[model samples]
Target: MRILLVLFLLAVGCAGRDDGEGVSTQRERDSVVGASNLPGASGVRGALRAADSANARHGRLDSAGP
Candidate 1:
C-alpha cells in the first residue's frame, strides 16, 4: 500500500515537470532576428519614429492647459 502511494506521487510529480527543451527552435530564432530588423520593432528608433508620425498626424496635444 505504501509503495503504491509513493509511486503514484512520483508519477504525479514527474508529470507536472516539463523538460523545457522546445523553447528556441530554428524558425523561431530566425523570426526573432528578422523582427529586430523591421522598421517598427519596439526599439528606441522604432518608438521615436512612431511618436513622430503620431505627432505629425494629430499634432501635439496640450495636456497641461486648455
Candidate 2:
C-alpha cells in the first residue's frame, strides 16, 4: 500500500513541467525531432533494453512486483 501510494504521487508529481518557455518550446522541439513518428513499442521494451545494457555493471532489475 505504501509503495502504491508513493507510485501514485510520483506519477502525479511528474505530470507538470516547469520550464520557463512552456508549451511552445515543447512543440518546437517535437517538430524538429519528429516525435510523432516514434516506433509503436510499449515502454517495457525500452526498459528491457536499458536493463540489458546495464546488466554487466549492476545486473538486471528483478521481476518482483511492488
Candidate 3:
C-alpha cells in the first residue's frame, strides 16, 4: 500500500508540472522502477511470481500412478 502511495504521488507530481512542458516518460519510468525497488515490495513481487510459476507447473489435479 505504501509503495503504491509513493508511486501515485510521483505520477501526480509529474502530471501537475507547469512551464508548458508535457508529461515526461523518463520520470514516469523512473517512478515505476523506484516503486519496484522499494523495500519489501521486491520480496512480495518475487513471492507472487514464484507462486504463479509453481501453480502453472502443478495446476492440474490427477491421480497418482500406482
| RMSD of each predicted structure | 10.4, 18.6, 14.6
Tens digits of per-residue lDDT for model 3 on 1-66? 999999999999889547566656754644565468577766666666686787776754333334
* TM-score for each predicted model, relative to the true structure: 0.26, 0.24, 0.33
- Which tens-of-lDDT digit does each residue in 1-66 have in candidate 1? 999999999998888656598678754555575468666445645555676688776654544457
Q: Total clashes, candidate 1?
A: 0
Report the lDDT tens digits of candidate 2 across residue range 8-61.
999999897776755476435544444344664345455555755777445334
Error of model 3, residue 40, in angstroms = 1.0
Full-model lDDT for every candidate: 0.66, 0.60, 0.66
What does candidate 1 score on TM?
0.26
The weakest ten consecutive residues by lDDT in model 2 span 56-65
- Ordered from best to worst TM-score, the candidate numbers read 3, 1, 2
